[model samples]
Target chain A: MKHAFLDEYSGLQSPMHRLDPRAKLVGLVALVVICVSTPPDLYAAFAAYLGLELILVLISRLPWKHVLGRMLIVLPFILVVAVFLPFFNKGGGSYNLGPFTVSAHGLLVLWNVAIKSTVSVLAVILLSSTTPFPELLKGLEKLRVPRLLTTIMSFMYRYIFVLSDELQRMRRARDSRGWSGKWLWQAKVIGHMIAALFLRSYERGERVYAAMLARGYDGGLRTIYLYDFGAVELGFVALVTLFPLAARLLAVG
Target chain B: MHIPDGFLNSGVSIATGVVAAGAVGYGLYKAREELDEKSVPMLALCAAFVFAAQMLNFPVAGGTSGHFLGGILAAVLLGPWLGSLVIALVLLVQCLGFADGGLTALGANVFNMAVIGTILSYYFFYGIKALLPKSRTAFLAATGAVAWLSVMLASGAAAVELAVSGTTPLSVTLPAMLGVHAIIGVGEAVITVLVVGTVLAVRPDLVKTYGYQPPVPRFEEAEVNQ
Candidate 1:
């Protein structure tokens, strides 16, 4: 039951992996905001953003295949917008592509969604892949995110694999019982499975709580500090922030 | 209804972000005072349950499959405050961990799926259940209807966000989004009813909103069992 799909590459040794999670979180999120906010027509700015991302990827030493594969997650959303491209062609100038008459405005909209979503998704992937999930949660806690929420999230991350493995076993059992999920009535079986899963998870939760109490757990979860935001982290934050801002401004100017 | 980034303009993103932040912050604050020691672990496990349950994809019409949207289901099982918090945590994890949703659009996604999908739908469920008779049938029926409505509401909210972002006019995104979700909502309703009904039968006490009491065995039946 080894499901580390969320941050598979996080343990790899690299410059990106060494930075404080808080710095990476803030810097990468800022990059995403700036990248998404830039006008669709600013091709140069978009290129700069893309270039910055490429440089970071290279520096991080993440495999191109991993990054490219993750980029595919955004394709469904991009395709949804792309499908309506023709209908969006209103007053904006129209372009004839054989049988289809798509508007320039519609094309712009597609580009906007496609590029921005791709870039934003890439940033998130880089952040997640470079930083282990626990460290990232710690970063969030230090960065003023609510302690309660972070604690819950950490727990969720911890048990997600266990529950999902449980789900997989259930699915296998169902399939073995000739439950092809073809007929509409088969939904009842799935429902029962979900309910059973909930019950099992709830019981497990109770047991975990009991175990925690036995170990002198006093409601609040505590961990020793491992991250320090010193010169390197600050410089990384500044470089990420100012470079994107400069690209955006230069493009606007 | 996980909206990716760039689908919404910064204005819509920021506005929804503020609203989502405010609501989730309040939820966190309330949970501290409201949830007891055991509930902390319970809530976390429930969130994990949701993430896992959503992966259980069931078949729909026309050779297609649809997955469960467990917002109303969660709210029904665990009151609105914890329910919405669970959905929010799932969305956040999906956004960062899987890159399933965009970083910039996390706020909008949380607003749509967590806020509108869970909290608003729970109130709707309460109203609908009140109107219906207090039988298991009525309860399951109400769950189905509200589950459908929750999906519709969430998709409608997303369409509005897109329109407000000026990504596409409401004329286009609205009909399109609602049209697709209308089908998806049926799947949502069916699964929600079945899941809720199953839980109600096995462990009615676990259902916070349902409050269904299992029938007590008669003396004759108990004697026979013995």
Candidate 2:
């Protein structure tokens, strides 16, 4: 019932956390662009990006353990793609390790991916850990993000748990019925289960829409509360834009 | 499959951002007729649910675990326009609040994960439903296949973005992305089938596609007789 998975650390108090959501949003975007645009061989530029991120991470006051833990989630996917680079990359000199050969070019490719992805992931973890979800959505809206997308997202975030709970209940019921899907024939049972879920979801959508109609909803959504962009927000934006530009200049220098 | 910032070039990021914004705007216009006061709360709750479900990683092979993209799941429950909008919103919040995706790269993330993933998945699933037996069983199978294909397709799109931007050579990037993601699609398909199946059993009334059917009438006489 109480799931704070998405914004677990958003409520923390820190300079980075105190900035307006819009500011953080803009600043991080700029930072990511700068980081991504750095040529793959620009080891110096990557280091600068890492340093900038580290300072921000510390400023946010998020637990190192938390950020690292969240990042670990993507490591497997990163590795799966980059793991064989050394064997397959044809550009560099090859080294024979018994049956397998490793290429210098492949090693570079692996490093390029691992480093960029890790740093980028850390930057995101820091942002999410610091900003609350509702405020974040508001920030996007204020920045002129489309209302329809936000509305849909807000609903998905809200009800995904309800659906998941429904799923758990069904799984429990199946288990109670001695439905152990270990054999090939049992796969059909799973298929039936899937069909049943689709029907239920379809029905729920209708009820939800009907409920919306009952609430005097006749299109055009307007909110009573409007977010004001304050000095803190402006400063935050300046800092975000400035940091990346500075990083780029330093890399070029 | 949300690529973080710094993964692709600035041009790609900005271009994708504009495209993402355009799609979201279009989606909002289309869903304008749909979002009333009742649907508002449901939309918010579904977004929260998507966030939660993404946290629980199911194990893939070789000690790896992957999270659900939820595009198909969302589309199956909500129609495509609404579903795509919801996913775009989630990605927007993810980039800003959670920083799960890049802020600058937000546009690209949305274009791939939200627009491409949700819209494409929805139409594909809908197409399959049309071609198949329209039986509940056929819908389930179609959902599974569509969901799987959508994930791979989304990944392929991302691969193309990276290639065009020249961030990574297409030769290395495209094959690498498609290879791993094709396997990831299996995970997406299984989770989608399992979750979709569960919802079908208990709350058949809740599903949007079933709205055409009249509600099951409660027999007052049976209760009184009992």
Candidate 3:
């Protein structure tokens, strides 16, 4: 029922929140690319990347709990994919870790996936936590992202909450009806629920289109330009961009 | 699967990014003809539907749960062009709004799930459907089979990308990813079939690719065939 979680902290008046969305998008994505592109053995560069991310996090004033909580979503993936590396990789020669034999190559691969993915996810979380969803979409549109895609995304964002609420209601209704959904054949209930949602959404889309046309629907969606790429945004972008690059160069040297 | 930012090497990421960009661009161009002004909102709403449906988790074996991917399902409902775009939109939102996937790896994820997953499943469903006699069971059976195969193929693509990025060896990643997804795909197949079957029973016209109507000459039918 509550939808504030999408951009819960975005309204806060921190410097990270005040910066232009375009600046934040560009700068943070640059940080991610540089961080990911860095060599796996570049511990110094990884430290710098993580350090820069932390500084931004602090500057943004987002709760450590929220950031860490969001980071946990990727943990299962890391464990499933990377945790097996040390056991499977035997390229760099094997070393016994207690009773288990592990390879240096596998351990390095594990570290690479763990660190890179963590830092990258954090960068995105920072970007999103600081910028509201509408502003982020607007920023994307301004940054030469295709208008069609952005418009589609904007509409999708608007309705995710509505549909999810409906889904929750259906789940409650289903559970209240005493259907456990345990047996494999019971997947039919889930399927029917999805079908119902799809039909509701489709009909709603048509109604929305008709309403838009009644009020003169056009191919392009228009919004006021509330963003200014001034000196503050420039400096923020430069700091984010140059800090990671410098850290990477220093690591190489 | 949503690959995080750091797992893919620059080369693999860029290459997939290029391929994804090209495919998305092409999809947009083709989808334009079908999506006129009227259906734009419909497409958006369907995109939202897919995103929300994905959040609906179903029970799997041993008390485990697997959520819907909605790639092949969307393709079945809305043709490959618009379906790919819808799935890509969902992926982009998940990456940026939710941080479910990595920004740098967005292209790779899009390529695997949206492009390969959606388009591949579309053709597969059609190819299979054509082989069977015209019947409700045949249509749904084809949807279920293609949905299952689509997940395995997408995961296989992801494993290959991981191997190419030197994140994992092909031998290890291939069997491991596919082996796990093989079970997850059953859920995908079941859900996809039920949804498509329900929609077909209720409003067959809403299903873009459902050929339940008698053979009639329609402008859209020609486009669908191509």
The value of fnat for model 2 is 0.35
Per-prediction DockQ? 0.67, 0.27, 0.63
List model 3 lDDT by residue over B1-226, tens digit each: 6999889888888999998898788877876777776555877898899989988889886567889999889999988878888898888888997788898889999999988899877888889999999888888898899999999999999999999988889998899999999999999999999999899989898888885565586565444544
User: Which of the CAPRI classes, incorrect, acceptable, medium or high, describes model 3?
Assistant: medium
Cα lDDT listed for each candidate: 0.87, 0.69, 0.88
Q: Candidate 1 deviates by what RMSD?
A: 3.5
**Which of the two, 1 or 2, has more lDDT?**
1
Per-prediction TM-score: 0.95, 0.75, 0.95
Any residue pairs clashing in model 1, and if so which? Answer: none
Q: Which 10 successive residues of model 2 chain B have the least lDDT summed?
A: B205-214
* Residue A27 Cα positional deviation in candidate 2, in Å, after optimal superposition: 2.0
Model 2: runs farther than 4 Å from truth? A1-4, A92-108, A147-236, B53-68, B96-98, B126-128, B132-134, B167-226
lDDT of 1 by residue, A1-253 (tens): 5465888899999989999999999999999988888889988888888888899999999999999998888887767655587556576789888887888888888888888888888889889999999899999999988788888888999999999999999888888888777756668888889999999998899899999889997778988668799999999999988998898889877
Off by over 4 Å in 3: B214-226
Candidates 2 and 3 compared: the better one by lDDT is 3
**Could you give the candidate ranking by DockQ, starting with the highest?**
1, 3, 2
Worst 10 residues of 1 chain B by lDDT: B217-226
